[model samples]
Structure formats: C-alpha cells, structure tokens
Target: MSGSRLGPEWVPGPDGLLSRHAARVILLDPSGRVLLVRGHDADEPERSWWFTVGGGLEPGESPRAAAVRETAEETGLELRPEQLEGPVLTRSAIFDFFRVTCRQEEQFFLARLAGGTATELSDAGWTAGEREVLDEMRWWDVAELEAELAGGAVVYPSNLPALVRSLLTGWDGSCAHLGEVEE
Candidate 1:
C-alpha cells in the first residue's frame, strides 16, 4: 500500500449505483471511549458527518489488513492484525461524497488501545484531501455520541452505540450483518 492512495474505488453495482467495499474500526481506549472522525463533503462543507476510523480496502486486501492499515493511516495508531477483535458488525449504506453517490459495504472491528487517549492523534498522518474534509477527531463515550445523534449530527452505522455495547459484552466470534442504513 502506498501512502498516497487511500481513496475509495467507485465501481458500479447491480442497482446501477457506484459501490465500494470498506473497512472501519471502532477504536477504543481504556475508558471505553471510541474514536470518531468529523468531516463533511469536500464540495459541501455544511454536510458534515462523523464515522469510525477506517477506509476503503485496496484491491485484494483482506478486511483485517485494511482495518490495520486504515487505523494506522487515519488515527496514527498502528495495530497488529491479531489485536483487532470480531468485525463484530457490518453495515451497508448509500452515501454521497464529492458529488458521487456510492453504495458502501463496511465491516467494523473492535480494537483497544491501552492507556491511549485522543491527544495522541495529530494532523501529520492525514492525506491532504482528508485534512480538507476532516475538521477534527475525538474520543466519544456512548452518551456523548448518542447526544450528537439526537442533536442532529450524523454518525454512520446508526446503531453504533448499541453495536459498541454489544462488543463490550463479548462476542461468540460470529459477525452479524446489521442490515442497511436507509438513505
């Protein structure tokens, strides 16, 4: 993987819309806070949203590999593949970015960063384009996140807080499809 290439590949799907397979991780700290990225459409800054720390899988890259790579790239926290737990949850959604609409299939993993805190992140790891759309990155506890959602801020995988809670309880090693996020 080259550092210069982290964007999504928009391929046409059966419904005739562009599609992409992506990997996302719910990065947790010791306090149970999950890291989230805040950003907006590059062409429309007002259309902001918050999402987990991961991105598009490179061609032929396994989901775990993409998770590790994307976690490192997006959060500057390099993690070994084995450290990531159950993909726990999978979500499908159709969203727009840079004026192109895409059907995104994403898998979510659970990874813990012992003693890690939000301050460890810096702008140095982001791509120029990422920095442009991304306003900030922060660690959010479920209540804080839920408030944001209720307050009208967008967070992908609408059931995120519930999903994270499920991860906390423990998984039997089975990945569940969370169904679609109706656009």
Candidate 2:
C-alpha cells in the first residue's frame, strides 16, 4: 500500500469520524471588504485557493477563544472574544491533507474593524507549517470575489458572496448552518 491515505490518522471517535473542529473569522474592514488568505496544499502547490482565516481548535479551547487567538496569530490583530459575533456560519467538509482524508467542522465568527485595524502580518507570527503553505493574505471586495467565482477560481465555504452580503445587512445573532462543502 502507498504511505498516503485519504483519511485522518487517528481512529474514528464516537462521532464515527476522525472529527476536527475549527474556528474561522470573517474579518471585515471599515469599507466592508472581507479578508481571505491565499494558500495551497503543501503537497500540491498548483491547487491554490482562497479561504477564510482559521485552524483546528486546541484542546479545551472554545470556538470563540480559538477564533480570537487564530485571528491574532494569522493577521496580527488582537481581539477580545466578546468582539466576535455569531458562529455566523458553520460548515462541514471532508478533504485530503497531510496524508489523510479528514472531516472538519468549522465555525465562522464575524468581526468588523475600523479602517486600519490589522497590522502587517509579517513572518514573525506564522507557524512554521503555515509559513510554508500560506502564500498571501488579501482583503477582497464582494465584486472581486464574484468575478473570481465567475471566472472559475476556487473559493471555500461555497456561497461566499451570499454569506458576506448577509453579514453586511446585519447578523441576526443566530448560527446559520451552511451544510457541507467540498474542498
């Protein structure tokens, strides 16, 4: 058999999957642009895509806490857990990575910032693994994202423009289930 497999390394938990939970942020600038990170699979660099900022939760960490921590680590912006609103969107996905096909459940929080809240996200803060795989981070307007989608570029969490528009109108403070997404 090949050394690689399309499943998580760990044994399936009671949930019947090697479940992983992630906390992501929909960070918005004053002008309402959303932040997206450009990254690629370490083993497949050509398969580049843009996605929100987040990672798997650490032991005993709540999703909100993880969101605040990850935002600071990935963007160099420190924010309180209270400042983040909603698990606005939740998504489930199954994909192959790091030699495994893993099931991931993600919770997305909305955090609006002033015109210049994010500082330069230099190499100083990136985890070694992230530094190797994450190419760049950008703030994108809805039109730009729509154009990319129309042009057949891959964007994660599926309906990105609709989601951002919902946030723009106002968050109802209820978690919306976004269902499954393909990676």
Candidate 3:
C-alpha cells in the first residue's frame, strides 16, 4: 500500500484507506451522564451520528494528551492529561467522512467532570473543519442513550450504551479491545 499523506495524522494504509490513531473521551458528568457530540458527514450532510468526544492525535502527542486536548476542543471541558483514566477501551473503526474512507485506531479514556453539574459547552475551540461537520453537543443518561440507539439513531462504537454502563460501574484496571467496527 502507498503511504501518502492526507493530513498530518492521516496516512494511506492497506487497501488504500486513510489511517490514523485517535484518542477519545467518554466524559461523564457528576450525575453519570456521558457527553456526546452529533456530527454529519461532510460529503453527505444528511448522514449524521452521535459519538464520544475525540479526534486524531497530533504528532508526538500521547493518547492521554490527545484525549485531554480533544475533549477541550470539542466540548470546552479542560482536563489535565493526568486526570484521564485508563484508555479503558480500544477499537479500530473504518468509516466515510468528508468523502474519504478512513481506518482509525482509537483509544477511549474515562473522565469525570471535576466539580459541577453544569453541562453548558463552548464551541469557541472547534477547528474550522470541526465546525463544518459537528453541530450538537449534549450530555446523555445511559438509559436515554439506549432508548435512542434502540430507536435507530446512529451512534458510533455501536455498543456505546453497554460500554458506558460498564464504565459507570468502575474500570477493572484492564483495557478492553472492542475489535473492528466498519460503517
């Protein structure tokens, strides 16, 4: 496969897919609600989905640092790298966005809102590209999220509800690989 650059993090990988590594945050609030973002395909605006807060890691940044940075950029929730808990979950996903097929290896970290119940988020930190596709951000109770998923709303990490439920109970100090997800 040819290794060509689409951007700093995205490189062409096997089968011609753009590949990258990302850090995701399964950020929870004091009440146990998880923060998720709603975004649409840049090439197909009608296709949208809800996903956890995250993005590709910048050059030389560790997953923990990227998790903290992505969370802040996507939700205005600033967190220190040390505050991010176990990359509790890891998974590889292939999806289409902005008309490109991408294979992303993602690590999911758990974090709790420090000292408030407030869910208000500022979009001031979003990048120009993020602003083009990301439209909504909100906190969801696991039950409500499950209801939406059951009702057919599209969500990434298709098993998100279950994962959130498990993480809520507490991490076992082991990282779980979720295998590969294609969409």
The candidate scoring highest on lDDT is 3
For residues 1-183, what per-residue lDDT tens digits would candidate 3 score against the true structure? Answer: 223323567887776788999999999998889989999977789999999999998989999999998888888778888878898999999887777778999999999876654668989999877888889998999999999988989998888889889988788898989777898
User: What's the CA RMSD for each of the models?
Assistant: 3.4, 3.3, 2.3
Q: Model 2 — TM-score against the truth? A: 0.87
The global C-alpha lDDT for each of the candidates, from Candidate 1 onward, is 0.81, 0.80, 0.87
Error of 2 at 136 (Å): 0.5
Backbone collision tally, model 1: 0
For all candidates, the clash counts are 0, 2, 0
Lowest lDDT sum, 10 consecutive residues, model 2, at 1-10
Q: Model 3, stretches more than 4 Å misplaced?
A: 1-6
**CA lDDT, candidate 2, residue 86:** 90
The C-alpha TM-scores of every prediction are 0.88, 0.87, 0.93
Clashing pairs in 2: 6-101, 7-101
TM-score of 1: 0.88
* Ranking 2 against 3 by lDDT, winner: 3
Give a tens-digit lDDT track for model 1, residues 1-183. Answer: 113232546667788877788899998888888889998887887898888988888899999999999888887877899989978888888776777666889899888877743448765778888888889899999999999899998887778888777776566798889666665
